[model samples]
Target: MKKKLSPIIAVSLFLAVISLLFPPSSMAGEERIQQELRDPNPTLNPLQKALGKKGYDRAMASGKYRYVGNTKCRLCHREFFVGRKKDPHVYTYERLVAIGYETNKRCLGCHTTGFGVPTGYESFEKTPKLVGVQCEGCHGPGSEHVRLHRDDASPFGMGIPRPRPQKPKGGKKEIKGGFLAGADNPRIIKRMCLSCHTKRWGRSFKRTPHAFQAAYDLYKTPLPGDEGDQ
Candidate 1:
């Protein structure tokens, strides 16, 4: 008589076969992230670390905004999206891939939009639309912003007027329509940029005092058809 496989071993073998056939991309991505989290080295980014996991989780959960990726942003900001193709930020994730750190959680925070957060980038296979440092990376999550604008643009739209900008409370800057206005919040923008552009990363923020401002200027440069809008 042939020896019977143990229940645990049989279940494992069955799942392995199923995975081979179905190839759960999202599950694989989650597993990859979990694996990185289990590693001895720290995986959370500077901002995430500052918040602490629980604090960060709470902020993301309470925000009620989701990352809609660059594709959604392109619907309205076509010029900016097209213009960004020439910018180096568009290829940030490819840079990591070239260096064989594509799945490195430590680097993903800067390399990809919204990594390690809710509704954020997972693996390229799972969240290909969010592969690079897109608009949401700097502007914060755009789900609410996109939804509001899209509803306003609808032909059968309700005639409800957009909400007036509310005064920020508690000295905390308020994001309008679920988006952080980077131009209006220079300090926040600078902090976001420097979170990744640290001395340890060989960024010239310290060596060149004006580097951040210069980059910010470049970031805000209007595309050919965007001058009047700006």
Candidate 2:
């Protein structure tokens, strides 16, 4: 009494039924996009918590100090190690290569610590192993002070972080970086953020706020198969 359906017609009808039964995935994807659009990179607020330009200028001057290599800085900063072969900052050099750069002294000057070194030792093999900006890279070398701190003797340089005034009751300071807050010396952390950003950038920032943000501490980042701490 009824006409038989073609095989193609049966498959199309089956797909239509399945589409009606199952919900479309576009709605959820759109919700995720809206959420990201609302507050992408919430942690960034230059006007609220920037280290400022003056802070970075003084920070870069430390590179011209006695020039203790990165290995020396690692002595105090071993806790933040990423366990990689090259220096954490050396990784930036690889990025430059992608855009056609050589490991020349001019390049390494900013890429590595002792790049534009005045001592006539600018080559990587010849320079200190601590290329790129480091804790001491901006905070000045600690060789004179590390022992002093341990011995409770006279302080070494002016780079030590002075004590902050006691916070008033119910008022909290939203500090940056766990290490920056945890450091016995905040100057080391501040200068670390300043070395690269202390360029001719202040004039442009007057129009809009863009604080310096540092992301070099690899240990703090999440690893494979590990759920990150939120």
Candidate 3:
């Protein structure tokens, strides 16, 4: 008569047989997916591709300016702020949450404003204000700009002063505020937009060369009370 196998031992043997039938590579791949899900600082290849290696290095080089959230931006740019609230970028993080990828670092880089950078979005609890893409997401950090604008004497000073057009010692004209002005750095801004809106995200740049510009135009469309204003 054959000896009776204990339930625990039988179960263990069954699992061992299953592992033998399936290669470790398949199991490893599943493990890698799970590990990525837990990772908070996964590689941001899209961002690197958008900015290029040098640009990516420069953008991540310093943590000088801190993100002050969209509310602080609203203090001065009420119209732009309100307009952005209706934009899809504002709810990108929430979209990730709905799909159960909120914690996935791969999705966070595009969904959230800034990730894996100093003073950037970390977690919902840690940085609730930075959860969504806001003014700083495209304009870069605004701490210095906010400070300079507050010190300006012009009543209509909207944080951006008239460009002096003076070339510094290096021959490169300096932007008034420490922010990335769309008029001054159109290329950089374009790259930033394309970084997230790539083919992978269903944004067809190849099929429609002007798709980005069209979307940008919509972004610039003035709100009800924002006519004739920046």
| Every model's TM-score | 0.65, 0.38, 0.65
Go through the candidates in order and give the C-alpha RMSD of each one to the true structure.
16.9, 13.8, 12.6
What stretches of model 1 exceed 4 Å from their correct place? 1-43, 46-58, 152-172, 223-230
| C-alpha lDDT score of every prediction, in listed order | 0.66, 0.40, 0.63
Residue 117 in model 3: lDDT: 57
Give every collision pair in model 1.
none
lDDT of 1: 0.66
The regions of model 3 sitting more than 4 angstroms off are: 1-50, 56-63, 152-176, 180-182, 204-207, 221-230
lDDT of 2 by residue, 198-225 (tens): 3321222233243232232322432211
Candidate 2 Cα errors over 4 Å, as ranges: 1-65, 82-90, 97-100, 117-121, 147-195, 198-230
Error of 1 at 83 (Å): 1.7
Question: Candidate 2: lDDT of 139?
Answer: 36
Comparison by TM-score, 2 against 3, better one: 3
